[model samples]
Target: MTAAILADALTQKVHQTEIDKELQALKEQAMVSGTEDSILVNKRQGAADLLGSLRLPHKRDEEWQFTDLSELKAIDFVAAGKVSLDVAAAENFYLPEAHQSRLVFINGFFTPELSNTNDLPSAITCQSWTNLAAHQREQLANYLGQKTDGNEVFSNLNTAGMTDSGVVWIPANIELKSPIHLLFLTVVDPTPIMVQPRLLVVVENNAQVTIAESYGAITTNCTDRPQQQPYFNNIVSEIYLGENAQVTHIRNQRDSGDSFHIATTAIAQGKQSRYQLIDVNLGAKLSRHNLQMAQRGEGTQTEFLALTTLAGRQVSDTHSTIALNHPHGVTNQLHKCIVDEYAQAVFSGKVLVPQAAQLTNAQQLNRNLVLSSKARINTKPELQITADNVKCSHGATISQLEADEVFYLRSRGLNDYDARHLLIDAFAGEILDQIPLASLQGRLRQCISCRTI
Candidate 1:
């Protein structure tokens, strides 16, 4: 063999050894907080076995070329222990719209004391995985950890270490009047910790529901540090929409600025189903979100609206894939990013229309605004169409605030900072207006105002 080839092989072997060691340590940690549910036990073991042979993704990988995991690898994190909090103390995190229909998880474990689900309708079933009934367990087995891109390593790691999950099931033909909230909170610790949180939502045929999911960090009395401690949050969510179902999903990620957050959301839509997603990313020193959606039946409709705001030295990456496997599918996506200071933002959106998916209409656009010379933005919007009759278009743009527009705003009797802030707000208002909840929209508007100032 050539000397270069020998060196490459040695590098691969070393990486594989490191991967194995990491997997073993995670598995041992999982066993300490293992679940008694038989189905979950089997699922965990299966994922652990699969992880044994897979290596961590690196810059050499195509999908992760722009994301660097070196900082994450440097921290040796242990599993977070079960912690308790008073319900009254967590009032600040509660939303008035979902006061009675919320589920709260702390450090990846369901916290019954801080959750309120007593006012939910009979058509909905919401509970933790450990509290699932026999029939529910049987149904969950069919979908849990099943719908994925099939190559997400962090997702598999979540399954391997998951001891509990938030499950939401809506029956057929039922329309929920209020939105359900899923709140996952991470607590900072003196020692770096790792937490895996999982969620499963299943909507039956002709059902309609709205979901608001969020992730944030909290501090306890004993540990009053200001979110400076490092932690890792690995999350996985699976959503299944039956035929003619309608689901509106809103996701918000506002973790600690010193933490690492990685998430995967896999969605499947049945015939004539409608799925709409409004995603907002605002925090975390380093974060990545992988969103995958597949149309399982004809006449499905999908919509995605995302906004990412980053500052300081933060890095945020979003990768989305929409597959139209059936005919008569329709999809529209718009992603926007605002980067300031030395922050960096990355976005890659892929739309696939195969030959079998005739008469598909798809549109994708990515827009970015840079506020500093050191700020960076990377965006790629792609459409792979094999269907001759499909109407598909994709485009991306990365630019700074328009000088002419800013000057025009300044002429309207506004200061330079106010002019720039107004322009930035207008850029973000397009996506924020589409959100279904007025309260959330107002909150997000305030957040944007503070960030710009």
Candidate 2:
């Protein structure tokens, strides 16, 4: 390789030494602060140990072949402690639909005053992990901090840094009339910091609930130059659904343009359970989502839908995996991305149907639209089926806007910008229309209409 190439490689190399030093500093700070309970302290220590032995994932990893963490490596991250919330500052981020059941967290710390759960039914319990009783903590020990062992450097790092989490439990045979919303707000911090927000949900047999999770930043005082604070949000969510349970999960990531976000959602479903997830990504300098789901029981149905819109120098990557472990399982997944300016989008969807997953039906599709000559998209769909009786298919497509359609709209007395916006709205409506909450749907549509740099 040439000298320039060698220099680039050096810069791209994983900064494991610096990352370890930061981790050690955080551990020392945790010990000195001594603000957390033994349960959480032990969990963080275990996760820190695991992360100490590993390095952040890079483009060399098979699952991360399209995404790079050079920007993340360049940052010197510190722990984000609790910050005083200006009630007026957080009002703009609340959702009216979930006004009665919303949970608010600032910089990954739960704020009870901003959260409303008083009108919720007695059967439904929503509380923060740090407030749980001793017995409750003991009950969740087996589930917390337990994930697929190695190669998950970010997940481990998140666990090590996790201080508190949100927990929701629904009893059997109950259905929530309205959706539960979680609002994670990142305020301006003088020092660059990282926050890990954890969520755990458990639904008993024959229960049903809807959850909407959103992320945003607090703006400064200047209206003319609304600047966003730089921060990193590493979030993890674990969901468990019992037999005949149903769940609708909608997550939106709209952070600051100067921020970084990495999130993972792990789900386990029981027999005859139904689950659907609608994921939307619109902000952040670099954002990635890892979705892993397993159908552990027979006759399960799962659906995953995602939409990514990027402009300027933004980058978005989504990697998802679905495993069918039992017979009579069905899955349908569709992911779409719209890129403009100098942005880039990446999608990787994989479905696995093992020998035991006979009579499985799976379909996966990835589609991308590039609105600018400088924009780029990389999409791939993988299907591995060993069951002879399974029906599985996967495909991908990348295309630019149709010139004839643009011309038709232009002839209808609409300007170029208007025509383009109309077409993009229609393109994104397919996924936006599926959002069950009208308030959330409208909010997302409005966000999609605005152009961000």
Candidate 3:
């Protein structure tokens, strides 16, 4: 079919009236909450208007070409009037019970009463995203949406709807001995509630800190509010790395079985700085993540790693972009997906090297394993290099276990299932090794092991 034909076909597609109404309400909320930050307000309001006019995925949207969200139009779920969380229910998702500091959120609202920070390092300061100083607002305003190109609709959607998300500051020259955990708990409701939790993290010059941003829905909903149901989660996180600063980040999203999630992350690395990301998406009806980075200074380095285990009819999509704009910057990205039953997974990795970014070193690889014929995987890895003095490469692979490898294991007295499980684990072991927390690492390993076995 020609382009004109495709356009005509999409124009004839139907959209759910409910999606239009929900979008209109979000726009009105944004207009009512006018901002002193003129740029932000304009972006938010304009984005809201754009989203309101969207077609809500007809057959022509190539980006959402693989999955259809027409069912999202039929749901009558409404967002709660006031979002809150029970303090007791908020304590269960912490890291191994061994983490020293934690900040909790229930249904996107910050729960200060339930947070514990006594275990924080003496030289460090940790506060709620709402409690940041006026001077800090500049950081959040400047870095929040500034991190990425907002390539997808969900990215712009997150930018327009979220206002209460927090800011994290690690002051200059401070090295922390403990990890800081930010926990988000979404309440289940009968009506669909769209929640976008935003984060702006700053690691000052020479500062060292590790952060764990964990997301999970309150699996058990109240019997009294059965009419209210669990909703969808859309989040965007942006990070800034100062010169010589080093940071480690872990983003784990394991929400309720029925909920949907979409996430995006953007990071900028400074000279001599190091940044790493570990993305583990284990839950959600349909989950997707977009990650990107810009090497704006010489000697900066970044590592991107993601591991996903999905079953049922669930699907996960990940797309990453890396740009090296200065000399001697380095980037390494690796991702793995394990699909079971009727699940599907997608991966896209792209690297850009500008002419000015000389002597850049970049590599990207995506690997996937499918456990059943009903499962499918799509992998695309590419590189765009303009610099003559650069070392850049990209690759991808998708397959099941090799019969010869399985035969060797069975001959050595191992069951076929055990042998297959071992190989899958080994494929993801590199990412699992980079996790610094011993307890979380072990838990993740066990989670993957059980599902694979």
Candidate 4:
């Protein structure tokens, strides 16, 4: 019995030793891609240590109760540090001249070689955030991570590895005549590429700008086989809208189906500012998006929308939070999810109004259309309002394809499968149509239409 106990104790120690080595490897990567920000490093190290303590999720953590990450833990994925891409490979993302300010990142590092700026409008200056003028960087550091408290483990990791990320600044009162188009390329797939997209948009008072961001993969890697089972795409986005600044933002993700994607986007909008955010997710095996926004100024307006279509064994989870700390602030959010096959989906939204925030207007609507009964969707909408004068509402609905809608389409001479697909497309149209850029709108619509039962 003493010998057996010693053997077991030794096994446990060896296992822990391997885990610590793995975490240290991740930390070394952060040190290699150095960021001058000391605060970011301290926070990142703390987060890494904390996450190392918790076991990988297994459908138990309340926030991640629905999606299962078992497949990711089973494989050994390589860390993808830096990559390169040519200009021609980015043809799929062709934004018109009217909205064609470009910022390109190849393998999470800003690549000037893959970017185009000749056709950019004179009013909008297109350049890498890392190369920003000295004054701009100082001003940006003030509000860089202010909106996000590093609430999640993933955000802290990205914060520590911030050297590769970029920023976009629309100086105060500079109305961008066109929408800025930012692109990130993830090549070197088979080796389990890890891509981190970092972004910050500062729209100062009376500044008006529109941004369209998209991601794509360039290389297919079979060099490492199954060990590279789970590729990582970790993205962090921060947007700051000053008083009376009107900004519209859109993000599109079309990545490898085997990829594991986790993203956090936090926005801060000032008084009387109007900001709208739209997220389009059509890829990834296990994907989650954290959308958190805060309204600090009065009379601010925000519109948030998301549209996702899942199939096969894919899973997508979206957690959104809208906090109103000031009086007379307004926010509206809507999420539409479509799941098929044996896939699962989840949507959680929380709206808060503090006692000091009187006359706040907030509402959340979550709708899901499950094509197969086996395909599941879970939605939790929570509201916490401490202000007696606040007006807040939240509602969630989950249903399958309506027979009548399919029948009406079938009456138009379409097959049952075609009819079902058409109705689902229509349901997602409302959210995709919210994209102001015509190219972006059409591309998102096409992605939605290509979904299969």
- TM-score to true structure, per model: 0.91, 0.90, 0.84, 0.86
lDDT of each: 0.84, 0.81, 0.72, 0.72
Candidate 2: tens digits of C-alpha lDDT, residues 1-453: 112211222244433454445446555665676534677767766665566566667789887887888777766666676788877888777777788898899989999989998757976878888777777777777667664334587777667666678988888899988788988988857666677789888887999999998888876642112254567788888888889999999999888888888998998899999999999898788899999898869999999999999988888999898989999998999998989999899888889999999999999999888889999888879998889998888999888879899999999999988888888999899999999888878988888887622
Q: Candidate 3's C-alpha lDDT?
A: 0.72
TM-score of 3: 0.84
lDDT of 3 by residue, 368-411 (tens): 88889999887778898889999988898888878898899889
lDDT pick, better of 2 and 4:
2
Model 2 steric clash pairs: none
Model 2: lDDT of residue 114: 91
Tens digits of per-residue lDDT, candidate 1, 1-453, equal 112211222233323444345445545555575635667766766675665555678999988898898888767677787888777656766778888999999999899888898778865888898777877888778889898655567887787666678999999999998899999988788787788899999999999999999888886531111366889888999999999999999998888888899999999999999999999888789999999999999999999999998888889999999999999999999999999999989999999999999999999999998999999988889999999998888898889999999899899899999999999999999989988888888888887777766
Rank candidates by TM-score, best first. 1, 2, 4, 3
Task: Give me candidate 2's TM-score against the actual structure.
Answer: 0.90
Q: What is residue 78's positional error in candidate 4, in angstroms?
A: 2.9
* Model 3 clash tally, residue pairs: 11
**Model 1: colliding residue pairs:** none
Give candidate 1's total backbone clashes: 0
Candidate that scores best on TM-score:
1
Cα deviation of 348, candidate 3, in Å: 1.0
